[model samples]
Target: MRIVVAVSLFFLTSTVFAQTKKPASKAVAGPGQQVYEQYCLTCHQADGGGVPNLNPPLKQTDWVQGDKTRLINVVLKGLQEPIEINGETFDNVMPAHDFLSDKEISDVLTFIRSSFGNKAEPVSVEEVKKVRAAK
Candidate 1:
């Protein structure tokens, strides 16, 4: 009877600890994840793996980590025509997200730059603003 009670207590404690140890959902979502989910998730997908031949993936691509101004322009002016990324060609039209605020664009770009197997510098609001101003 004592052994049974001890086992039950151990299992209860283990279960409680396991529940407590689990990471929170919000904690896992970096700054721009919400924006990504709202505007970009549909085409880009939650994993940043874009639609085949239509949308290009954001993972470790030059489009995400390369020239900051160009990346910002892509967001502000939108992307069209055929572009090759990772040896794959994407010819879809990514409509302008110019309506989004500088902060939103900055946060989203920063999030993209950092997430999805991408490790790059975060984009600033000033950078987005500059790119928008250029266009």
Candidate 2:
């Protein structure tokens, strides 16, 4: 009886392990994506459509794809005034994220510019440093 039970348990465990085995995921998120998910995803949302009348949507907005210097400054200095984008006015206060490193800022900006259907150039770490220095 013991021998039969041991064999049954061994086969059951082996079958369970075999059935539970899963393929490794191939869609690993990039560093920029990681940063966006960690910080920007809250306000901007995963789809880049911000909350109505509060945080502005990032989808194809000039702010994401426009002048690099101005965009970088927006991240470093934060915007307090009510701003209009695509004819929509957003009055929410965007706190300054100056604590993020130049690379982090650059990566996040680049991620935003490339994502959300915006075809802007990538923001280099050097550019972020320059903008941060100017402030």
Candidate 3:
């Protein structure tokens, strides 16, 4: 009877394990998405469009898609200059997120680069660290 009970318990546990399996997630978004959700979402919105003249849209923006250095500088040093987005000008002060770790910044930057129809090269932590080390 004890042997039978043990066999039953093993089968039950095996069935449970078979029923429970993790589904695979899509491509990685890195820390960029997390940082954006935590900091930029309130103003930039989830769609990457700024609040009219307040915040600027990152979707297909020249500044966001034009130069890698420009984008990195904006992330590391913050952008005080007025930026034009979707035919509107936003002079808001974007506080510098330099405090974020290289990996976090890299992930966030990579997310931004690929999202909002703004397909671009991925930003790496090594690149971010290189930029930070320069200053």
Candidate 4:
């Protein structure tokens, strides 16, 4: 009985004196990154180096860094025609992502433009909204 009481008291004291460990700081995924992982990670890959001969890469590509409106439209209306980039032709089809909201599209475009070693301006929500409305 004395041993059990001592053990219980020790555990209770330890519990009262225990210190909490600080949580490790982690890089939080933004809304755009979450959207990309869900919808674009498959074809574009995690590094944005798309599948060879199947999908065009997003690294330092003009299409990803070019006009914001055109990029927005491409997301809204899937590309059907084959396009060549860096002397490489990709005939694979890219399905439309029109189901995404204007904010989502804009955030994703901005994320793409900034990722994969591309330094480009962000795509505003208004810009995406305007392009979607025009279509």
Best by TM-score: 1
lDDT winner between candidates 2 and 3 = 2
Span of 10 residues, lowest total lDDT, candidate 3: 21-30
The per-prediction CA RMSD against the true structure, in angstroms, equals 3.8, 5.6, 4.3, 5.9
**Which candidate comes out best when scored by lDDT?**
1
State model 2's lDDT.
Answer: 0.87
Clashes of each: 0, 0, 2, 0
lDDT of 2 at 3: 100
Which pairs clash in the backbone of model 1?
none
Q: What order do candidates take by TM-score, descending?
A: 1, 4, 2, 3
Per-residue lDDT of candidate 2, residues 1-135 (tens digit):
999999999999998887666332322466777888998889989989998998999989988898999899888988889899889998888888888889999998988898878888899999999988888
RMSD of 3: 4.3
* Candidate 3 lDDT over residue span 50-76, tens digit each: 788778888998777777667888888
Which of the two, 1 or 2, has more lDDT? 1
- Which residue runs of candidate 1 sit more than 4 Å off their true CA positions? 1-24
lDDT of 1 by residue, 1-135 (tens): 999999999999999988877766656776688889999999999899998988899999998999999999888889988899999988889999999999999999999999999999999999888888878
Query: How good is model 3 by TM-score?
Result: 0.77
Runs of candidate 3 exceeding 4 Å displacement: 1-30
Q: What lDDT tens digits, residue by residue, belong to model 4 across residues 18-118?
A: 63222222234677888899999999899999999998888888789988888898889988788997679999899999999999998888888888888
Task: For candidate 2, give the lDDT of residue 55.
Answer: 90
